[model samples]
Target: MATTSCDVAIVGAGLGGCFLAMLLRRRGQNVVVIEQGPSIPSAGADFLKPPGLRVLARHGLADLVGRHGLRRDHIRYYHDGDPIQDCRFPDGGFLIRPYRELVELIYTCCAMEGVEFWFGAEIGDIAVGGGGVEELTLADGRRLRAGVVVGADGTRSL
Candidate 1:
């Protein structure tokens, strides 16, 4: 088996994982993202809320993500054919984009920052020591050692 090391090993390539990887990489951390799927996930939430958009803007990625996304500022609810309530959003409202597209965009940014990605990687075993992860072994016999390990693999993650 071959062994490799990185500053951070993230177990997922989903939005959170990829976005975090990009941010960490921008801060000069050596990051490796491991995903069990063949590629970035194709299904997920389609709305980028205000808080999330703010975070992206803080990182100078708001424009990139919003370039082709649909923008909405308000949503109205009706009851019995009568206008009930109108919910207005602040800060240009939220963005409407497919989950995969959003993730791919962030993934591209992470790649440009030199964050390594290992797709179709299945975790075989995780070694923990001193209340933290020490190493991760892949199903294909590859080992990864990192200063920090994050299980952003999602709701069904290990």
Candidate 2:
């Protein structure tokens, strides 16, 4: 068993987690991302709306993600074979990219930023103190202590 420490421990390798890790790393924070899966998540939101795109653009990743992504400006909703509502997107609409592709792109960026990722890592226990997470123990007897712990592990996070 080995013990480690970081400035931040993110408990997920999904898009949000990876993106956050990259941002924090760029700001000189020591970050470690743990994922139960063997790799970046394969499923996620396929649409990158305007606001979301804006955020990526600010981070200089808009061109990378939009390079090969499909763009759409409007969406039509139907119910019972009847036209319901039509929604139009502004500012070049949104991007349609596969979930895996999107996550992979961000993961690559995180890697380039030197963010550490632990794949197939399962949390066995969480030690809490002073109303905050004190440490994390992995199933394989690895330990991680971080100043901040983030649970971006999605809807079913531990």
Candidate 3:
């Protein structure tokens, strides 16, 4: 019944969504992330590759995101039960956390930045025009008007 507005409205609280929200909020944007599920998606890419870690470091989250997660410097490849060449990571290392745990860490950081999360808010209709999304209408009659809309809702997202 109530309409809300944000500088950026992102659908889905996956890795991309949470990371983007944190970035925008840090830059002084009011961000809202809508998720149809109760929390962040349970599964996704498991490794926080070096490039990604660098980006997080710029945001002062390098230690926070990597803390407590496994530091992976090497990985063994296998083919048909036969050991193949082992690949090694360069520089420091990559952070290896389960998909859920990785996302949860960023989600927690987003909360600290005042990013709003609308969990369990199923989306209904999206209005688009001017080569961009105009607004989003949720199933429960809630409308969100965002200056910009981002779809980080994962594969098969609508």
Candidate 4:
């Protein structure tokens, strides 16, 4: 088939993938995001946590986060039907959302920002070069060449 090239090639559309795509696109860089799975929705839970909170704040998503995030107060540690410790949050809180939803939102933002997406494309082999990534062979026999390749395919990624 046809071969494509990009400044950056992201393997998965997970949190890091999407955020990186957004950042690069904002800087006027061409990026190709390849996903082996279908895009899902994004829930704003990670935005409410500590590190992610700071990160989202930098991205200007903190306000939206407070509106849609969950506040986790305490956790009860159980030891075989016995309560071991009850952890409490004094000033800090945690938030979480479904993983599928997060992926969906990322994909949506990528689309709006004109990031090229290759869904259902399973990567077979990869070649790295001095400049950057040389080539990627997909399961469908399609070849993708790029100056940079990022492995955001998550756990169990090839």
Give per-residue CA lDDT, model 4, range 28-145, as digits (tens): 8899988887553242234345667678679865565555556786778899999999877556666655655555655677789999988888888887778666999898988888
Clashing pairs in 2: none
TM-score for all models, in order of appearance = 0.91, 0.96, 0.92, 0.80
Clashes counted in candidate 1 amount to 0
Query: Among these predicted structures, which one has the highest lDDT?
Result: 2
lDDT of 1: 0.93
The C-alpha local distance difference test score for the whole of candidate 2 amounts to 0.95
Per-prediction tally of clashes? 0, 0, 0, 4
Which regions of candidate 1 deviate over 4 angstroms? 76-86
Every candidate's lDDT: 0.93, 0.95, 0.90, 0.74
Question: What is the TM-score ranking, best to worst?
Answer: 2, 3, 1, 4
Model 4 collision count = 4
Candidate closest to the true structure, highest TM-score: 2
Candidate 1 TM-score, true structure as reference? 0.91
Q: Candidate 3, 3: how far from true, in Å?
A: 1.4
Q: How many collisions between residues are there in candidate 2?
A: 0
As for lDDT, the candidate ahead, 3 or 4, is 3
Error of 2 at 34 (Å): 0.4
Compare candidates 2 and 3 on TM-score and give the better one: 2
Lowest summed lDDT across 10 adjacent residues in model 2 is found at: 149-158
Worst 10 residues of 1 by lDDT: 149-158
